[model samples]
Target: MSIVAIIEFDEAGVATGSRLGDAATPVLRVDDLGPTRGDGVFETASLVHGNVQALEAHLARFVQSAAMLELPRPDVEIWRDAVRAVAASLTSQGVTSGSIKFVLTRGVEGSGVPTGWVLGTASPDFTRERTDGIRVVLLDRGYRHDVPQTAPWLLAGAKTLSYAVNRAAQREAARRGADDVLFVSSDGYLLEGPTSSLLLRLGSRLVTPRVDLGILAGTTQADLFTWAESAGYATGYELLTPDDLESADAAWLVSSVRHVAPVRSVDGRHRAVDGELTGRLNAALDARTS
Candidate 1:
């Protein structure tokens, strides 16, 4: 429901059919405090064929993120059931495939209590691969947490809802005539793509930056790493530089939306795509999901 209806939760762990109203799923009570204040955290996960992929992993990050933001922890099982309920509603409404984004915010009192959240779905449409491939640009910006080492306490690993910064970085990348931006650390080590994980293939080694560099520990990258390690591709995570990226055998941006999209050109310089690694990684992903 795009409309945010009045939700009544009962003691038996049941949330009534949200009473219809003139509102959006994103709109909490205008009078309700949290929605207006932009205070809370959330997680988006892939829902396919009634199964939530990597759900445990997703919630782990969500909880950790919310805790860091000082948001109260809602009952995990209840939220899980709520998500299933919404997906079931969509199923009854005849939506078969796509992604679902779940957002849980701080309660109306502005206290840490969960005000409630909205679960929404998108078609997840993406353009087919262009043989010309994408061009990447390096922005001066790099992620630096107050505390390094990528510990959970700093919320460096949480999936927070504050994505405005990420969006702005994408705009900056586009302004520079690049398909994406690779965040470099203050010390000039590469971290990640704004909305994607940075991965490179050097012959047989699949190299990604260490999470300690203050990057979002991407689910897609983690899954791909698992396959790469098992298939003897020599998965590795190390600090890389702009020079390392520009001279890599091949590179791609990994995420839920694009899967594995190759970067053909960086700073207007063209590079060869790694068809073999892409095919192998894609095949592994398909096999796991299928």
Candidate 2:
């Protein structure tokens, strides 16, 4: 059974209706650019204990993405109402822990308005990966790290819904018997996972790829860094390479719902698991979100 709720929205971002646990329900028009041309922006937020986590941050990013794509600015209040309505509806349907996805797309072919909605779905079980860690492989993203600065038209950092390439990379990783992929730039700078941000520990300081490297600024990474810093750990946003990851005491792929999953190996180069650090990081993340 599909444990997902699809909520449709009107121009004012009000919920028109909802279909629960039905994946075959037609939610978007065939002419919608989101499906036809992949012209849209989205955010997946963890909904814990009936509260949407980091909603404001996600909204801000969604608005920024809309502006970057030349789409109309989303009315936050309308979106707020729609999201709360959907969340409340899902809660009534017995969803205690799940994810809320916000989507805004260029509307039906020539409609001149954007299509928007919020979807609530049960979170995937990542217990084994989180507990045992994951094996990852590095793949070239086929672009330089500075491409975002050099060409704004590429829509870098926009969180657009054009994810075919990212999905394909993950599929290739699975084919190679790896759990996930870490995208590296043509110049060999480590970037990020398909749906996550990369972070590695260097002695007492934690380092992640620079935002200028054309990667999405991870909200989970930001939260972890803030908590970790106050708890007496230094952090850095610097260019990192595969060699740096191999040398780190530990590394993780951080995302909103998945929390933190340790990287057990990279390109089959095994590293010792720092279970203590992973536990502490997860503890900090839980404390903040809980």
TM per candidate = 0.81, 0.91
Candidate 1 weakest lDDT stretch, 10 residues: 1-10
Pairs of colliding residues, candidate 1 = 2-25, 72-112, 107-115
The segments of candidate 1 whose C-alpha lies over 4 angstroms from its true place after superposition are 1-27, 31-37, 91-96, 109-112, 127-132, 142-155
The models' CA-based lDDT, in order, is 0.67, 0.82
Instruction: Please give the TM-score that candidate 1 achieves against the real structure.
Output: 0.81
- Give a tens-digit lDDT track for model 1, residues 1-290: 33122334544424443433343434465654445665667666665555555667667777777677766554666566666666566556566544656666655563323456545464454444423357888775544532355444545655666667778988988898988877777678888876788999877798998886667788878889998888888888887888888788999888764567788888788889877677776656545542
Clashing pairs in 2: none
In candidate 2, what are the lDDT values of residues 175-270, reduced to their tens digit?
988999999999999999989999898999988999988898888898888877987899989999988988899999988888789999888888
TM-score, predicted candidate 2 vs. hidden true structure = 0.91
